[model samples]
Target: MLGSLVDNVVDMFQASNVDWKKIIIVGAIFDFGFKTVLDVLQYRSQCRASPPAEITKTGLIDQTTFIKSQNYSKSKLRFGMFERTISLFQNIAFLKYNLLPKIWEYSKVTAATYFHGGDIVAGIVTMLIIGAGSTVVGLPLDWYHTFVMEKKFGFNKQTFKLWVVDNIKSWVLALILTPPLLAAILMIINYFGKMFVFYLVLFMLVLNVLAMIIYPTIIAPIFNKYEPLEDGELKTAIENLAASQSFPLGRIYVVDGSTRSTHSNAYFIGLPWYKQIVLYDTLISENTSDEIVAVLSHELGHWKRNHIPFLLASGLLNAGLNFAFLGLFLDNASFFSSLGFNAGDMPTVVALLVFSDALGPLTAILQLVQNLIVRSCEYDADRFSVRLGYGENLKTALVNLNKSNLSSVDADRLYSTFYHSHPILPERLRAINEEMDVKKSAEKKRQ
Candidate 1:
């Protein structure tokens, strides 16, 4: 029977004599060290005298812009490195002193004392405690990053009171929604027992679908205002472009993102048959209508090529694998003992926390592959836009966007591959130009 096989596997794990605590600590250090190396590489690239000749040749990125972009990027990188170091040490110390088990015990006792002794209730309490702790610890860093760092770079638009309100709203939203969601997930895992991975993945898929449905309609409006894009020549052009591509354009909403930051973006969200595109008001304000439509052509390229679905499928696969990986270690008795608990009585919530923290370092190594796929898709989307006769406009829009955003257009190859989801600006421009040349050649041949 299945029980017999599981027992044998458990016995084998017991015999392995793995010191999981030390192993996890070493893994964390190694992962952090690798990332630090990437940071150093990026710093060197950013410190270069100028950007590549290709980017300079376009006469788009002037010396002042290039220097400003490098300085901004380098400053952010340094800030990020500092924050990450703090997080790394905190995690290491948390594990070293065995705080997770203590928190679980406290949550369990509290649940028993007041919540009528339910596992789900205890798990929810445990998560809330952890969330509160994280929020408190991160508050100062968040404040400094927003008020000091971003403001120094001329990006912060919110007043201190507005920032405070935003944080309070986020906390309230999390408090209202998180407990029930966590409890439901715990229940699914408990109900499925050994086959939890299979059921958990399905539950998560359903949850993701529901989130897509509710986020724009319900969740997003809570934080910011969404207004219909006004009737204009721009609107008419966007409609015609979508019609030419047979895109299922439903509604266009411009979100009030300028209240927080000057950065611009555009993305589509909805179910298969009814896609909605949301543009940052900043995007509309900053770009020409032609450029905005051209930028949207690149976005439509993502939909036309099924990139979103591909990413979704890949994400689900990754989640399934992570669940399976967790399953492997769940019955590893030594791991529980190292965390000051026994495998037989280990709380599912506690086990999940331990596994997530300990396994993250190793799991992160897989990110390179995901980044590679994403970068390729960006190139493909650019090419798609080029094929649609938006190549020149897209390039101009991209340049302006990059300049406005102060994006680091040049990057070290290794660091870029390991970190950036999109190709560097110069590389993207080169690819776009090549695609345009190819289109022109094909037209000539046909003629």
Candidate 2:
């Protein structure tokens, strides 16, 4: 099955432009047509294989009946219909204006072969457009989750006042920061063409390092207040643990996490000199300081392993692939003009997303590979925490978190592999158990 899938993907990539478009259209149609079929199949499989199959007081319906009833609901079937409807409206609105075409016409790339000057400017502008447009999509989803879902789950901390303030602050920050960075990208792409990816990768690394230097000290404070872990046993315990590990963290502190949700977490943010582990107050209330230390240690392991660097590299590689593909596809006039973008004035930046959208399968594969690697790192970090003598504490924290957040413990491997950045609860628990055995053996040797 995997081989066939891989072969099909490779063929799609090698296919001619017309073939590629046909494949895209077919994939999109298949994605729409079979959406409900797959969802229903997976849902039914889960339901059938579910634990504790208790014959309840409510009359039993056979699987056939249940399937029929679910199909009749028609909710699953509407997934593509809703998406298509939204896209249709968006196309209609965009089509009414030659405004975008005029803009593209103005920004036309004149370079014969390599990345041109105009292409870079257009690319940067397009990126900003996407980033801005995405913020529009993302902000609402975040708000919905924070205000509605998280609140319903009893996790919210902020008031309407705080929420509004945070949103405005975030938007202002994006506005202040995005344009110049984007402009720099335009300059590089215009000058370097294909070589722009190299510069982008370097720029991203520097950006991440800068963020590491400043995030805990600056950016984070803009949203939440942080105070030193109070003068108490909790503080002393955390400090002692950090000292023992020689972990180069600046301070242990608490954030008012309960203002949003009952779920608790702890994280190490910023670089070593400025590194601070911010524990949710709710975490302090529930888990012992030991567990918090274990959690912090795991987070510290992420830093030590330079996992963020790994993530940054993955992002840059993805961007490079995206840029290359964009260069390839954007040259095709039909894809551009059909989408209401003027081929002549085609902003390289906007065309970037259009190309990415076209290369959807490759992006998905890239993300999937990256996600699988990240999940493995989560296990490695767990082991690192165990080496610091906090394996049990980490396990305890994970259990508590799962309960508080109401996440299922026993998700399928495929589900976790596909969607989870962190390994699922059972897998993590198993890893912790293995680490505990190693710890006991080391202690016996010490004795």
Candidate 3:
């Protein structure tokens, strides 16, 4: 069956005279449109469903807040649909007009004239130009989403100046970092031929590790102020929790997340030896000390369960698979020709985009699998908090977090399957409540 499907796809490609650019653009639109329509339908269906009796019975939020959350969800969904539709049309226009190839050619010629090196330097320069241009083009939509949509919902906490600064910082960072990475990958491809894929995977692995190490100390501080959690009962409780779990807790810092949005979150960052915990200032303000401790316990649970290393290993595996497919595409002349590029003259940058597009369906499958893994890990982490006797507190924190963020606590199951990294609030609350019941029953039996 699989072989027949592959043969059919190949036959279809062989029959079509469409340039690879057109094929990719059309395929992208179809793929995105299909997913977007399905998601919107799901959103609409959820909205139409009678509000769950559990929602009101649980008393997580008042009716007003519940209505507000539903409106927020629908508004975001409608906005997303609009954004994606516009993007799809823009992409079609861009490809149909051959703007990408034109830009690529222009960048190549300019870089060659100015740079003393060979194609590698020119390739890097072209990529940088293309990258910067893409970022610039997307900025307006980003501004609207951040400033207009979020502001309407009372979530925007950023000034226009801060937004501009962030954009500038992002572009500057990309300019500084991306060129060398592209240069190295191109050099490897030139030097090692097919083995370039394996080496590229290793390069990515090392780069990710370096990012993890530098992110907390270097990159993050550029965005938000991070102050060490001051001497207080909350600090002491967190320390005690870590000590009890035999977890090597590093410095705890509170980030000024309120500077950007009202969202509350907690995360663990840095290497094991230099591990740090960061709590959003909004989380600190919104939640009690016990609830905060409960949240940290869940985070520590991820560490205790080796979820970080597990995710890293999974990422490396995914990279290996991607590069393997990339190697196959690079070796196939027909693949390049199908995409409207002469096989003989295909640039590394162009080939990279084609390789990625070719593997889109496979990437989607892999992402779905990864999401399932992530959701399972979240459940395990929740259980870990329960084991630490913070189950009730964690449940309370989850409820409050969902309420404050205006997140729909219950989502369409199918939608959750595709999109949610963590279980919906109701599912999590059910699990915690069940665990508490079991614990209580055991205590009663002992008495």
Candidate 4:
């Protein structure tokens, strides 16, 4: 009966002469429009008359810092609005001009000239062309954000020469990596055909694991220098904490994050038995050893709770769903028509992009659910940190991180709930306080 129902639905869908182009364009509009509305809400929240009393009364942030933070938030919001508007127009232009088809044709010619114009080779060329175009489009915005706005807010630490060097390196890396990656994906699609989704998921899972191993150890150090955290109270304390938990600790390195921005953070990486913790040099400078340890306690809590695997699993599920949907559009001639591809000659890459964009609302919905789950994990990690007796220090560290970074403290409930993977600072603090109270009460009972 279920099979019959699904067949009937599919038959109805096929019979319906849906305007695929219109559906895709409309979805883009709503996707961008909805996010714009949320940003506006968040902007309003940031525009509140003053910082929260709890924050100010505790002297976590002075009035001057609060004002700076508010202004910073407002500036970013204004910038975001402009960028989104530009992006919407760009998307429209790309679709209306049949840019993908033009680019795909160009890629085919280039491939024919060089690589013999096989579909897989042409597909790789097409993706690289798109990537190059996107990189060109985004560079100016990225520069203004990094150099102009961030410098205006006193956060940009990178020199112009360094920035230029960084970009050169990034493009070099992309050129080296993208072709083979695109070829692999295209090959899987060609070989698996109808079962591409399953194969793609497995491939992506391998890529994710490789990224986890490579990014911090290999890729990141190319951009920023890292050094051993010299023997110190902070290192000693971190080691002690790890010892208590029987965590397999390896090398502790401090990354020169201050070279680019004043923002601070710490995280752990590597396989289960030989884990490494990396602290941003900025985090060491901005925070006391205890507060830094407290921050890392929360980070380690994530490891303790296996949040990395959970997040990885969630990402796989998301990718699986994405690929499955793309597979449905494989035989979709009308969808190819919408993408400006000849009905029967549709490339997997074109179908992937068009279907992904057309399904924007669905992805946004998925993002909200993912954010909710991630935020819950954050709360749980906070509780774990508190249980480890770092609650007070963690609270102070949170305040300092926000103050240093000029982060917006006030958040619209809807916007925050929909977008943020971690609970806002105030929410985190409140939860930590509640957990502390529980801990203290339990201690009293034990006595």
lDDT of 3: 0.79
What lDDT is obtained when candidate 2 is compared to the true structure? 0.63
Against the hidden reference, what TM-scores do the models get? 0.95, 0.75, 0.91, 0.96
lDDT of 3 by residue, 1-447 (tens): 998986665565545353566657767877787778677766775574445654555676777777778888888888778777876777667666766566667767877788765667777877887677667778888998899888988999999999999989988888888888888888887788968878887888898889888888899888889999999999999999988988878899999999999978999888877688999999989999999999999999999999988988887887787776666555455555554454465567766765666566787777788888888889889988997889879988988898889888667777778778888888888877777788889889999
Quote the lDDT for 355 in model 2. 58
Question: What lDDT would each prediction earn against the true structure?
Answer: 0.86, 0.63, 0.79, 0.85
Per-residue lDDT of model 4, residues 1-447, tens digit only: 998986775555344376777887898898888888999898889878887656765577877888888889889988998888888898889999999888888877888899786777878888888788888988999999999999999999999999999999999999888888988998998898878889999999889878878987889989999899999898899999999889899999999999888887888888878888999888888899999989988988898998989988998888888787676677777777766776577787777667778778877778888898798889988999999999999999999998888988778999888878888877887789899999999999999
> Which is superior by TM-score, 1 or 2?
1
The candidate 3 region of ten consecutive residues with least summed lDDT is 9-18
Cα lDDT tens digits for candidate 2, 18-84: 4433444455555444443544443443444332122111123334444433332233224434545
User: lDDT tens digits, residues 1-447, model 1?
Assistant: 998987776566455587878877887787788889999999999999988977888898889989999999999889889988998898888888888888888888999999787778888998999899989989999999898988887888888998998999999999999888888888887788789998888888898899889999998998889999999998999999999989999999999988998888999999988989899998888889999999999999999999998988778877887886677666667887777664565677777776765676547756767788888899999999999899989999999889888999889999898888899899999999899999999999999
> Is 1 or 3 the stronger prediction by lDDT?
1
* Deviating ranges (above 4 Å) for candidate 4: 1-16
Winning candidate number (TM-score): 4
Task: Give the range of the ten consecutive residues with the poorest summed lDDT in model 4.
Answer: 9-18
Count of clashes in candidate 4? 0
